[model samples]
Target: MATAHTHVTKQQAPPHRAAELSAFGVLILLAGAFLPIMDFFITNVALPSIDTSLHASAASLQLVIAGYGVAYAALLVLGGRLGDSYGRRRLFLIALVGFVLASLACGLAPGVGVLIAARIVQGATAALLVPQVLATFHHALEGERKARALGLYGATSGIAAVVGQLVGGLLVGADIAGTSWRPIFLVNVPIGLVVLLVAARIVPGTRSEHPVGVDVPGTVLFAATLVTLLVPLTEGHSLGWPWWTWVLLALAVILGAVTYGVEKRAERRGEVPLLPPSLLRLPSMSRGLVMVLAFSIGFGAFMFVFALTVQDGLHADALHGGLAILPMALLFFAGSVVAPRLLSRFGRAAMSAGAVLQLAGLAWLVAVLLADWPHVYLWAMAAPMALAGAGQSVLFAGLFRSVLADVPAHLGGIGSGALITLQQSGLALGVATLGTVYIGLAPHGASHAFAAVEYVHMGIVALLAVGVAALPRFTRATPVTPVTES
Candidate 1:
């Protein structure tokens, strides 16, 4: 009897040990997280260079941008599930390797078609990589450590947005190796390789306590639904809003309904679905997702539209265009850095305050645009941009923290995946819907088109602020903790 008891104790030991993460390890993980996000923003700045060099048509340029996004958004949940079922660290490494190879292909591609294909693959690889980062932080660290890590993650989002554009501008202008815009993709090779080498050693492995096989049927349906919805929205304006676009949109709705039904059935059958319906019912998660979606749409649209308006409309070069967004990025970093302390003091009110600041910034931008018209430059736009950035920083920091605060540890991968999927989808949708509006209005004038879209973005921020008011406040007393491995 004593021997059997000892054996049982041994069996429990591995599951009982709480994982701890080091600062260096967190940096490594954040670096991996930063890569894909940085790529997305960098590509925004590189678009014109790509267009001029590749001679890409309008529709093709849209594809270059939307292709990566569609693929990433569609498969993200599946990637998260794969990490949970197998090993988060393992999946992350595999995805990084794929990202490196795909980035190489993108840099070397001789034509628009190859570049688009490479970019789609690159996006798909990013899907596999992202959830693992959040899941690691969720499972490995506890208490203040977890909060600090999360704060840094939020800051990285804004920092990458700024750095990506800045780097893209510099790289394209430099034309290193006489390859215009190629360095943007190629540059990832060395950094990714270094991260890959160190990650295997530094990154901890974590998976769901109750691992399950891949839900093939659910993955297929989910992918189909996203593809159908995003494809038409992305390409429609460039394609003259074809009848097929509407058809695809309708099919997306049908597929989405079907996907839900299938997931519900899977839950009833005691089988794991891509996203558990019950998970969505969690008050913290659901409410946070709503706010996140709205905020992301505004952010995504603002970035894409603003870049085009400044560069194409105002005839600013890539460097100047990127510089124009610098103030926002800088202030965003500041807001993220102070967010933890702010949250501790003000709780969810911090997010609401962020929304108000963002609204003010948008109003300011409209005023500046009206006053300066075609004469506007980076210095002229600094104040409003900084205001908007600070607002976005606080809003994102709070929303990300609040959403995952109550997630069950075993569901970390799935929860992280769901949150990110919504965010990415929001980003894609913003680019599609708001981008289409801006393009349609472009004939009137760049300033007119930009002002109109800014209003739309402002409306989204206002709604997000109201949503923040309703979110449950997070306190230091209620720290995010991991569940038992069993």
Candidate 2:
């Protein structure tokens, strides 16, 4: 009996230890994922403070935001490839340290030029870290555990957007140490340090079993494509639609075509491309990427518009603006917590249901906006906001899962990078497009402009509902091929 008992204990030990480690590692990776996204939105609330403090020109201020986004989006695929070629753990740590140093530089910069430069560096480092989070989860976890982790990842993403605004407002409002907006960037220092120490101990070093070499030409072309495309959209309006903006837009189209052709040729030559065309050819990947783009566009647009409505239109302070959306943030978390269970029971249908719910919530909110107009109270918007948040949470997780469902494990890093790159691009596009619409119409009437935006959001969500509903119920996995490193 004693021998039998000892044998059982020995047999159980490894699995138990692994489970604990997996959970802790996920927490660390999620922390890494959270900071980059949070930093993106956190600065939104602090922008006014920054402008006042630095006496920044409008163009430089726009650069402060656009620069970070463009850098992050452009280099994401390269970051993923590096993690795959070298090691995810190594790259994650290196990127985390870079992110921390960049954050510090942003916080302490003596002038706006230095701040913009640091922000771009901060975004570039974030690209290096964030993709590893998803790739590691894909490579390491499986089945139910994978589902739950993905759900949590979706939750972390949604929550970070809201928390960024909330924390930024609070920090600016409190004026910690009389530093005003600086605390928003500086706070990342301690949190990042703690995560770094813990991650070193727990996060397993994982990389692609068949690593792909970095494709330099493809990388440069892709980066150029995104920079030309995103820069004009983000800055065109503020710069009063300069002739150069149109020229860059035209260049972006040509560059994008060239990049695709280069990547395809590389694949044909039996070289690993930065983004493999064959990977995008997978039905699950292509279709799910579209959904991700649409969802992100709506989300980004709504968040940007709502913040302006509360702060500029309603004349609320930063803290109050953040507070108005607290219900949405809380419910979003709750929905994410419940999403894995729903997916287990309902399969792909769960995503459709989530979209439907989101549409309903949007419709409700739009009605309230139309009815109350300028007189709308914060509490009046709470119910619909919460409903929409929960729906978005479910849809986000489901979409994330679907996108990678057919991707082979060996390609997880590049696949994850593609997923996030589209997501970030959608966000920037959303802000540029719908945000422009809102801003243009605001002078006519803030309430009317907001209502118009919400109507567009409903249309987007309604289409999303149809798209998710039409997705194939099952995904066939892509087969992996062994490649000898050249």
Candidate 3:
């Protein structure tokens, strides 16, 4: 249920906009929230340049991306829980400040070592800032206003996925002020500084009266599990399949098992486990999370593979490659905008439809690849790309609501964090497994190699469609998780 009118007036609603504050305050809050997601995609296009300029290896480059994602997924829950315990506004400001400092450190990094360190620290601070976005909106808005806020937030994510490419390509290709790839990191400075100042004035502070204490042990254990699991997945290929890679992978599994035991013990003792056991108990929530992991892995690997196929295999320049993805980008925005409406009507059926469409598109795409491996062009690929893009956008909105629908307010942060962690682990795995397979299969020409890679991905995407179809039938737009007193 939406909050009482009295609570909304007291807690979050600003009197007016211009005439009063209105929901514009919440809008400003979302702008600050969007930066980190944008940063993730933006960095991918810039990675080749970063590698060449800084003498970073393929392994180190993967680390730059993986390290941020690992830290982000691991600590995101803690960041959200802190907002619940302390205050959302206070943490937002502090996290914003940390993000700025970290951005500056990344921009100024002289060597590969410094850049990687800054990226990890930057990811950590982003964990703190982003959780506050959804929590703040939840605390502050109600009814139609709340739905609009969340829909818009998800839309921003959709837009960022596209904009990251445009911005990364333009800036990196500009070689602006002769900064080369450095401009990509440097550009965040102005944007971050401005958002910080504006947010201080507009966003409201809100926290639940009753909140769980931070689970310190759970945080450490979870972080360790993610780092151990993700590090080798991202770096192992470069190390020539070392024995340590297998060792670390096994250890990550063990650490994750131990972490669950610790959380179970804490729950038994009537303490807030790092992740509340009840979270996993919700069958829909469980399925939604698995969907998040599967979806993100396939999504992450698809983008990475496409970039290599276009640029390295086809000999397209950065600008040309970025422009080629524009059709998908445009339809993605369109799909996200229309999805909230579909959710209100068709419900989880919308998700099923999205999956079927994506599978059709991927299957069509595979046919084109196998038949015209040496002669494919952007024009030939546009149809499947656009359909897949729209289908994917719809899929994410459905997934987001499904994951959080039954989440208790106290543990919303953890639930969201856990979803992201599973998402990232899946993403890292996709890149490692799918990427390794594609690279291994394409032992000859760049064109044939790229063709083989897409064929594999089409099959993977088809598998993901089956999983999405399996999502609990009730997850139409949003399945209501029964609020429990536990």
Best by TM-score: 1
Error of 2 at 91 (Å): 1.8
lDDT, each prediction: 0.79, 0.77, 0.71
Once model 1 is optimally superposed onto the true structure by TM-score, how far is the C-alpha of residue 236 displaced, in angstroms?
1.5
**Local accuracy of candidate 3 as per-residue lDDT tens digits, 1-486:** 332222222333231222122576776777776777777666766776777789997767767777777777777777877877777779888998888888888888888889989988988998888878777766666677766776677788667866677677777777788777777777777887887787778776676555556779999998898888777777777678799989999999999899999987776666656666666777756878877877777777676666666666666666666776777788889998898788767767787788777767766666676677667786777898788888888877788777777665534445666666677566666666666655555447655565566666666556656666555544244422111110
What's the lDDT for residue 228 in model 2?
89
Model 3, poorest ten-residue lDDT window? 477-486
Model 2 spans > 4 angstroms off: 1-22, 55-63, 137-151, 475-486
- Return the TM-score for candidate 3, rounded to 2 decimals: 0.88
In candidate 3, which residue pairs get closer than 3 Å at backbone N, Cα or C atoms, i.e. clash? Answer: 16-20, 16-21, 16-22, 17-20, 17-21, 347-476, 347-477, 348-476
* lDDT by residue (tens digit), candidate 1, 375-454: 88668889999998898788777887788776665555456667777878788777777877887898789888989999
Question: What is the clash count for each candidate, in the order shown?
Answer: 0, 0, 8
Per-residue lDDT of 33-139 in model 2, one digit per residue for the tens?
A: 89998987887777667878998854565567667877887788778778867877789899999999999999998899999999999989998888777667766
Off by over 4 Å in 1: 1-21, 138-143, 205-209, 405-412, 477-486
